[model samples]
Target: MSGDPLERIAAALERLAPGPAAAPDWDAASAFVWDAHPDALHPVPEVSRVPLGLLVGIDRQRDTLLANTRRFAEGLPANNALLWGARGMGKSSLVKAVHAELEATGLKLVELQREDIGTVGRLLALLRGAPHRFVLYCDDLSFSHDDAAYKSLKAVLDGGATGRPANVVFYATSNRRHLMPRDMIENERGSAINPAEAVEEKVSLSDRFGLWLGFHACDQDGYLAMIRGYCAAHGLDVDDAALRAEAIEWQATRGARSGRVAWQFFTDLAGRHGVRI
Candidate 1:
């Protein structure tokens, strides 16, 4: 209190500011969410996810991602993965399910938000020499006009000078295969003096991911299988014929047939029966 007013004000400001984040307790949890502001990894003890067996549709996608993840976990050479395709077809779910399925092998999943792409380099540096292998996940990843954050992400994935750590691999889920709208790439093509190179630079971001597993929309049988799987797992006790009829009616009302819709219908059915899933 006796100090000069300016000095005292500065001291107060410093105290009010956040301190450097604590080093992550990597062993504390199987999953983590990377917080870039304070620069810390937050543990996720209970991940919100469905069991891999319950995922129902997209068997091929499920297998491909699992294989690549397994290779990475075993310290074998593995490609960064891009899970792209129809919405709610389990792109993000597959990533989480795969991590959960393989967590016993010391594979850790770290979710980095799309907005935090610029800070990925810092996160990679932290994970570079760690004993454990990490799958850096970004769900719903995409880029818009003039957003340069993707450059840092590209550098980290492609491994600029140091190269990506053998212990770390990146996985992302996106509705767009290129993580950019077709129009966005076309716009670059329309404006650039050299259209091919301009477009190549933008679309090549996806190329960094060696595994481009696409999850397409499921068919009627696929959708029904999803609903039946959930019903059986949760003990809904509904007859097969009745279940199919209700599920079909539900999809008709909603005008869609995907895993998400199946789950939504199951939720309603459970609610009516007073069964908590």
Candidate 2:
């Protein structure tokens, strides 16, 4: 034990400060969830994601993201992608599905929560030198009016000094196209002396993403197709007429029709029919 007061104080400070995070075992799993408190990547042995073929609507988004992810995995040029638009349109699902399809290419998926946006630089530093390529995913990403975490996100997307590691590509899903609420942008425009620049400062964060894919609300036909696809995949036998009537009634009850709503309906139908999905 140190007898000197200065040495004792230094020891206490060192103990309080978190130690450098340990390097993760790259071969542990295909997907991981970043835990910011302890600064660790927890392996996800089984990622809950639907098959690429089963995603009925949004074929255009499916193809584009697949191609982009493929390029990144192959060590070719690729862009950080932002999947933004309507709720329950499978923005986050697509990210996972694409990564699953390309997992054989030595590509990995690391989920970064929206709350941990500030620790992205530290996360990046850990992944910078890893051998496997990573798709850094953040689901339902959005920023509030007073939040400054967006600046940290900019650093990841813009890659300030040490450019984003060659092995890492960022992919985020959000309901907001600009990653901020419309009211927040309008607030900035109303208050700032230079309205354009003020709005631009916040909106420009989205411009950092090279690929901006938008997912809109699925049409009735598209919604029905999603249900049919799920039924077929699980081999749940139901008459088309009955299925249509029941599914329509279900949608009516929910007051919305989306891939998610369709799945919810199918889940109930499957349970009734004793079919496991």
**Model 1 CA lDDT for position 48:** 91
Candidate lDDT values, in order: 0.88, 0.91
For model 2, what is the C-alpha lDDT against the true structure? 0.91
| Highest lDDT against the true fold, candidate | 2
What does candidate 1 score on TM? Answer: 0.91
Candidate 2: where is the Cα deviation over 4 Å? 1-9
Q: What is the lDDT of residue 127 in candidate 1?
A: 85
For every model shown, the clashing-pair count is 0, 0
Over the full model, what C-alpha lDDT does candidate 1 score relative to the true structure?
0.88
For model 2, how many clashes? 0
